[model samples]
Target chain A: MLALIRSEWLKIRRSVIWLLLLVSPGLAGLIGLFGVREEQPGGPFPWLIALALMTALHAMLFLPLLTGVYAALVCRYEHAGGGWKQLLSLPVTRTRVYIVKFLFVMGLVALTQLLFLAVLLLIGTAKGGGGAIPWSELLGSVGRGWLACLPLAALQLAVSTAWSSFAAPLAVNVVFTIPNMLVANSADYAPYYPWVQPLLAMMPHQNGYDFGAFTLPSLTLLSVVMGSFVVFFLGGWAYFARKAV
Target chain B: MSLRILSAELLKIRRKFIWFLIFLGPIGVVGLQAVNFGLRYDYLVGKVYRDDLWGGLIENVTILMVPTLFIGLAILASMVAGIEHQTNSWKQTLALPVTRTQVFTGKFLLNLLLLLVSTTLVAAGTIVLGIVLGFGTGIPYGVLLKACYYPFLAIVPFIALQNWLSVTFQNQAFPLTVGIAGMVVSMFSIRFGDWFPWKWPYLINAAKEPLYSVACGLAFGLVVLAAGLAHFVRKDVK
Candidate 1:
């Protein structure tokens, strides 16, 4: 497992996935710096507004979409020129390899979330936000949002494993991801929809503005996130375990 | 320019899930509008009385279509290139009698044609969606078609740029990420001046005269295409 994780980490150094990280946070920062915020300059509790806007673009579409990209890339080399045959011929169990790749994707997503957090703080300070940073609230939302992405990461990994064409999994993810804007709007549908969960977790219910993250308990949120995560992870695991590759 | 290469490219995309993707965007856009109108018919028609509901429907559809168009083009470009990239077959394709420029042009044109087909579906689907919701006979065909199409005309520059990026990079993630970022920025593109290509799709609708975006799209598209083709032609094919 350790060896597998190390190899995955090394593969990323040559890949541009890290550079892709800068896109969403960078765009969100531009949006925060330029767009008019609801909070008066230096008003009390300014974190939520910046977070609200940033996460709307960040977690809602980009995060999930990025997950699919990362997942596909994780398997990109393996799909090329019998790389999978080379890798699997080794003694390592397929389960461990799958778990490690999934972990790497989750780690990449965490890095993205942390980048979002860093950008959030930088934007707040740059704008001369009045109050002290809402460290607990900001961290809490960001963490919850990352937690919500577990199921997505698992599912994307499965699809990426299934498809050799790099863009096919992404196409699948995008078709699902684009609807987050509309799905997140419907109170009846938002909670049940997996793609919309990260956005729901990141923004407080009151700030949702028809985002429909309201009235959900943390325990229920946790169960739903973990429940879907298990289903996807196990399904992907089963598929890979039996896959001809 | 060779009919041989162009037809070959079209044949390659069959059974490759590309057709489903071409159909997905139009249907998804129309489907979302159906839900929107179905649930809130009273709010859309009743509360905003005297406002042409057809115009309102187009407005709502534009918001969805603009992003869909941006992201869709990028994926199409990447998938087109990926057909070769997955097996390191660029050398195989370029070694043919066709010039590299011809191959690149074929991919870009096929993508543009696919989007054109999708856009027509959007126009047709929107009309059907409106009629199904009883939008009545006063269909604003001219404005609806313009709303559906002027953006495609104006967005040719972006099509070139996305094809450029996708062709240059073997990994599709970079181009796809850029496309998503473009989508995010396009949410704010209405505030952008006419010069920005990403803004052109949405701006075509808002501009008093739609031709402004058309001129920009064509002029910029050729330059980008030439630049991309030059790089593609000169670069060492792996």
Candidate 2:
């Protein structure tokens, strides 16, 4: 698994996709700065809320798309370069290869979320003075957001790997994101849509730490991640194992 | 020969799973609008955000979905062009009797058609939501058409931009990133309004009253499209 991950990392380092992964989060953060500038100071929350919302919107719409494209790009290394046959020809099990690849992709996405948070933290601190930052809230939001996106990341990896078309998974993300955003607003549906769960998890209800209401979201997200991982990993293994170069 | 190449390229796109993305675009938009309508119907029962269904459609659908839609179109367009690069199939395809221009045009036209189909679904969905919400009766047909026309027009340049990027980069991420970055910039650029092409699509979709600015939009789209196609045809593909 570690070897596979190293190989995947090496491949990622060689591609233009890495540059994009690095730049997109920073660009999104810079865009957040503009939103912060425009925020009305007299508003209920600090100007940081606007920045947070902007960052969240960018993440919601683009993050899955990025993951889908990256997964597909990584999968392409095997499919197009005759690397799959070479890798499988070795003693390594097909399931192991799939697991490692999936883990690496998921790790990359998690890193992206972290990088985005880092950019936000840096900006927030710079603008709000050093110690005025809401470290706990920001860290909490990042943790929940990453957890909530686990299912979505798994789903995207599966779809992109299965289809091997950059557009297919991205299209799926786009189609689902709209509903995710809309359904997320309602208390009843927010639990089921894993895409929206991250944002909802980070939102504070009227009551403090409404874990009872959040239980469903937590369970749903966990189920989705596990379910999707099984299906996608099995599916990818099947394809990677039997596919002819 | 051109028609043969065009048909073949279209056939390739049809076979790819990306077609599902195209088909799902409008359906997704419409479905979300229905949900939004259902969720906020009580609050918006008799409220007037603007004069007609155009206003309602603008208020409900355009602001939220257009950015996603544009992103979708750009990514799809890029993938359609870039897949050849990823798979090293461009050389194979180009070695055939087809000219590069025909291949590019065929794929470009297919993307445009898909965009239209997706936008049309969104329009129909918006109108349906308007009626269901009891807001459709007050809207004039011209207002609704005008409202729908702007988003479609606004997406033209983006489609063109994606075409250029996809053809140039052969990596779908490049164009996708641009689409996302452009969307983020447009959110901030909304204050500038007329001068910014990035915000034009959303503004056009969000425009309440029928105005002459739409002509500017159409003209801008045509210019961008022509420039994009020109750049695409002249550029050499690896």
Candidate 3:
């Protein structure tokens, strides 16, 4: 398994997809730096508002879309010229290969989260007051955002691996993710919807009326997120194992 | 030769569900509102944008539709070129008597035709949804027409760019990555000015003299189309 992961790492080491991953953080950082203003003198954690506002779209739409794009790009090389057949003929199980590749994609998504966090820290120190930053809230929000992306990456990887055409998975991702803007507004649907989870997890709801009986770290939300991750990851793994290629 | 190539291009996408995708773009945009009004029709109509309901609804749809149009153009362009790429038939197709210009032009014309159909659906969908929701009988036909078609006109340059990118690179990810990033930037470009081509769709709707943006899209699209053709003719198809 380690060797398989190492080989997969070599495949994505020097690809153009890394630069693509930076886009969301880069854009969010720029918007946060210039657009947000100083809070009132005695506010509690001014940086929280800036961080939340900046990451709203990044986590909601752009990051998940980036996940799909990267997953597709990672599988793109193998999909060409019957490479899948050649790869599967090797002395390894398809399940192991699928797991490694999925791990690599999650790693890339984690990198995006870290970069977004770093940019938020930078803005906090530079433009925001030299006051004490809410490191826990910031990291927790971004961490949960990454958690929200796990099922998405799994699903996107499955779709991308299933389709040889690079655009197919991407188009599907865009079509599904665009409506997050609407779904996140719905109290009834937002928590359970995979695409809207990141926004619900990241944004600090004011009324607290939406998630009645459930908080971000509530057992129910965790089970839902983890359950989705398990289902998609295992489902994709099963398909790859039984697939004709 | 041109007619034959155009017919072939059209035939290639048959049974591919590309038409479903074409109409799906507009329906998705209006469908979001369908849900919004369906759930909260009384609240929305009673509280928000009651004056000139048709204009308000159109404006709301356009806000989300710009990004959809931009992304849709990229996907359509990619799907067109992707057929040849997936089949490994680009070199074979170009080797025929048809000029490279005709091949590229055929794809462009098909994309334009699809987008026009999508725009019509959006216009028609908006009107239907408005009537269903009882937003009033006053329909601003001119505003609705402009809202639907003007963005299509303004998106011409992007259509050309996406096609060029898709045709030039065998990998569909490159063009798509560029298109998604362009969509994000265009959301912000509405603040900068009219110079950014990504924001042309929004500018056309928002500009004081909207004709200028429409003119920009038309002129820029023609220029890019010529440039893309010149590049395609000289490059080696692998």
Candidate 4:
């Protein structure tokens, strides 16, 4: 498992995915910085405002789509030229390999989340936010948003493993994810929908938006997040282990 | 020359999931509105008055569909290029009697055709969705036509750019990332002026004349297409 994880990390490090991951957050932060400035020059809850602006783009669409792309990139080399057979032929267990790849994708997503957090903080400070930094809100929203991406990574990995044409899983991801903006607003469906979890988790507190009203209670939110993580991770593992290379 | 290659390009996409994808773009966009209106029929309908309801429905669908169309076009371009990339047939196809320009033109036309089809589907689906929601069947023909098409015209530069990126990069993720970032920036650009290519799609319905955007899309799209094809012709295929 350790060896597989190391190899997976090596493969990703050599790719442009890391650099590309920064592009979305970097753009969001720039926009958010300008947004904070324009909204009354450090007005009420500037950190929350900056976060709202950041999450509005990042959590809603970029992160979900990026999750799919990262999973596909991690699996890209493996999906080519009997690469899976080559990897599985090693003494390493397929289950461990699958888990490790999934872990790497989650780790990449976490790095993106942390980068986004840094950008959010930087934007807040640069804009001279009026209030003391909302540490709990920042961490809770960013951290939970990252956590919400685990199930997506797992599901994307499963699809990536099954499809060799790199864009197939990605298109599928985009098709499913683009509706997050709408579905995340649904009072009845947002709580249970895995696709909308990141949006819900990343939403700023009392933002007076439709999404603000749609957030699940903490207990329900935790259950949904953890529950999806288990189901997708295990289901992906089972399919990968038995899938014909 | 162009027609033969166009048919060939279309044929290539058939064995792949490109058709399903072309259809998926509109279905996804219209389907979201279906659910949105289905759930909040009274609230949404109440928000808009009688005759204007049709325009409101088209407008609401257009707002959401812009991002969908942007992202969807990026995916379609990649998928079109990926068909050739996946098979390692680029060199083989290019080495044929057909010129690279013809091949590029065919691929570009195919992408345009797919976008047109998706746009048509969105227009049709919006009409269908509006009727089902009982928003009165008077269908604002002009608004509906513009809503369906203006974005497609406005998106030509982006389509050209994405096609270029996808065709050039063996790894599809780069173009996909660029497109996603474009979508993010485009969201913010709406507040800015209409100078940016990403902003063109939404700007078609701006308060000013819509032709300003349409003109930009045409001029810029051709320039980008020519530049991309030039590079594609010169670039060595592995």
Candidate 5:
């Protein structure tokens, strides 16, 4: 399993996809530099406000969409010609292969979240945010957002695994993603929707409400996230196990 | 011969979902508007649509369509190019008795035609939506047509850029990422001013004088398409 995971790492270490990973952090830094002001309308801390805006951009669109791209690309080489047949014909189990790829994608997502954290702090200090860095809150937001992306990543991996054409899965993901503006606003639908979970979880809920659209993560919301993650992860695993190479 | 390539390009995507996407692009945008209106018909009818039902709908729909247009073109270009890339058909297709520019022009036209249909659908759907919502037939035919096509004309350069990237890279990742990035940037492009390429689609909408973005789109589109043609013509296929 470890070697299989290593092989997965070797597959994408030099690909152009890593450059795509920088988009979230790059955008965060840009927003921090421009969009946020010293004294803003929403809250007290400029850094926190910047963080909130950054979370909205990343969590709503970038995180969910990039999850699809990464999952598709991980399966890219395999989908090209005979990579899948050759790998599956080897002396390894399909279960391990599926698990490793999902874990690998989660790792990529975690790295993106961490990069956002790093950029947040870097921008805060560079802008001379006049207070101690809010380490615990930042870490909590990063971790929560990363957690929210799992079901999305898993489902995207399944679709990517099923389709050889990269853009189809991506197109489907993009269609679903376009509605974040509407979907994230619905108290009834936001928790049930996978794409908006990261935005809901990552944004620091003020007085426990999201501009009157949603509240901070409650028990039901957390369960919904975990529930979808299980369904998608297992569904992808089963499909890969029986997938004809 | 160029017409033949255009027809051939259309044939290549026959069994594919590009056609559905061509339709889906506008439908998705219109459908989102449907839901938005369905959810708040009372509020919109009472407050937002006081005097101008069609105008209010037009404004909301235009804002919604730009991001969809940006992302949809990226996918369309990627899929169009990926047909050659995924099956490694570039060499075979190039071996045909045609100039590379014809082939390049053919694909760009297909992308343009697809989006053109989608854009028209948005206009038609907006009308249908207005009629259904009882917006009272004060339909400004010229205004609706201009509202849709102006943005379509303004975004021609991006369609060119997306095709260039999609054709250049065998991997669809780059073009698709750029597409999403452009979408993100365009969401905020209003802040960046009018000259930013991604901002073109939204910039010309409802403007008093709206020729700038269209002119820029045509000129820059020619440049990017020519640059891509040069690369495609010279680069060895292997």
Candidate 6:
């Protein structure tokens, strides 16, 4: 499995998709900085809104698409130049190959999230001028946001693998972008929908951070992650195993 | 030969990414807005951002800037037929009896249809959002319809550009990347407002009147579309 993953990683690196993936998050973060209103010489412009705006802007442009693109690229490698058939010709089981690819995509997602967090921290600290870093708040937001993306990442991977086209996964991402935004703002049933959890966890308040409104209970995150993992893995496995290649 | 070629072209489109956007994009937008309305009602209610808060809110929520939705469509449309060149599918497609004109038309029509469907979804999402936002009293149906029409008109140039890019580039990423980059640039450019016609998909919702004279934009769209078709018909797919 490790060898399979390593080979997949090598293929991704060779394809240049990995480099594209690494650069997009930072580019998106820089774009967010462009929209940031420099704190009016006196003080911050409502810290919560500023933070929320910063987080939401980056999340809106980069996070979901980044995850979708990463997932698609990983799955796309197998489809490129008939890489899947050649890989399957090896002694490894189909299930192991699927698992390894999925893990790799998820790992890439975590890395991007960390990159986003790092960018946010660097910007926030620099702008805040030696002020106490809101470490707990930032981590909380990052944790929740990253956790919320699991289901989406799973869905994107399933779609990309099943369709075997970059456009298909991209279309799926485009289609969901608005709906996900609206769903994230809903109060009644947002807790039930896994997609909204990340945005909900990042909501702002009057002072420092409104952790109360945005925090996702561990149980909910656990349930969502477990449910998505099972569904996504089984779905990918079933489609890849049964489909005529 | 023409029928076989056209059928093959259609099949490629069916397999393209644009289908997913056509089917699901607007539905997601509307559903998300409904949720946003439910949660942020307090903040939204009785709020006025200048004299046209209601209109402003409607525009902000309905605009394509929600998250790369419009740009994604533009990129997909621009690259749909072009991918054939990248994957060597065009060589196979051109080998059939069909003339280049037929193949180009088929792909253009398909791209147009996808764009239309996405626009319709955005329109529907906007209506649903208006109701959900508890501004049923404030939103004028005419304004919403007008706003929706603007995306269609504005997208004409984008569709044209996509067709042009696809034919010019053999690699699929070339067209897609260019289209995406164009959209990001437009976001900054349109902020100036005077360059609206060249903005290629005017941000109607954000405009003061939300409707403008799109004659120049329409002319540009037609010119580009005609030029793209002519180029495809004259150029060899190889």
Tell me, by DockQ, which candidate is best: 4
- Each candidate's B-chain TM-score, in sequence, is 0.95, 0.82, 0.95, 0.95, 0.96, 0.78
lDDT per residue (tens digit) for residues A1-245 in model 4: 77887788777776888688798689888778666545564355467767887888888888998999999998988876778999999999987888888788888898898899888877777666535888998999889998889888988998999999888899878877877777776677778888878888888766565443354587887788889888988888898878988
Per-residue lDDT of candidate 3, residues A87-200 (tens digit) = 788888998888888888888889988999888888777763557887777887888888888888999999989998787788788888888877776766666878767766
Ranking by lDDT: 5, 1, 4, 3, 2, 6
Candidate 5 recovers a fraction of native contacts equal to 0.64
| Segments of candidate 5 deviating more than 4 angstroms | A40-45, A207-209, B204-208
Chain A TM-scores in order: 0.94, 0.78, 0.91, 0.92, 0.93, 0.81
Q: Which candidate achieves the best lDDT against the true structure?
A: 5
TM-score of 1: 0.94
User: Predictions ranked by TM-score, top down?
Assistant: 5, 4, 1, 3, 2, 6
Q: Mind giving the per-residue lDDT tens digits that candidate 1 earns over A85-190?
A: 8889988999999999999888888988899889888878777664588788889988998899999999999999888888889888888888887887777777
CA deviation > 4 Å runs, candidate 2: A37-51, A202-245, B1-5, B39-59, B92-103, B125-139, B183-193, B204-213, B226-234
lDDT for each residue of candidate 5 in B1-238, tens digit (9 for 90 to 100): 8778888988999978889988888888888988888888999878988888888899889888988898999999999999999889899998888888888899999999889989999999999998988887889888788779988888888899999999989888888999988888788777776668877777543354677777777888888888888888898876
Predictions: Cα RMSD each: 2.1, 4.5, 3.0, 2.1, 2.3, 5.8
What is the Å distance of residue A13 in model 1 from its true position?
A: 1.9
DockQ of each: 0.71, 0.49, 0.57, 0.75, 0.75, 0.26
Query: Which scores greater on DockQ, model 4 or model 5?
Result: 4
Q: Which digits, one per residue and each the tens of the lDDT, describe model 6 over residues A22-129?
A: 454465466546656755764643334545766654464356666666777777656657777888889998888777877877787777667767776666666663
Model 2 per-residue lDDT tens digits across residues B1-238: 7667656667777667666776676666666776666766665544645344457665667666666666777778877786687677767877877666677667767777777777776677777777776764665666556556677766677777787677777566667777766765665566565667776776533454324345556787677767776776676656
Better of 1 and 6 by DockQ: 1
Candidate 3 interface RMSD to the true structure: 1.4
Cα error of candidate 6 at position A19, Å: 5.2
| Each prediction's whole-model lDDT (CA) | 0.84, 0.65, 0.82, 0.84, 0.85, 0.62
* lDDT-best of 1 and 2: 1
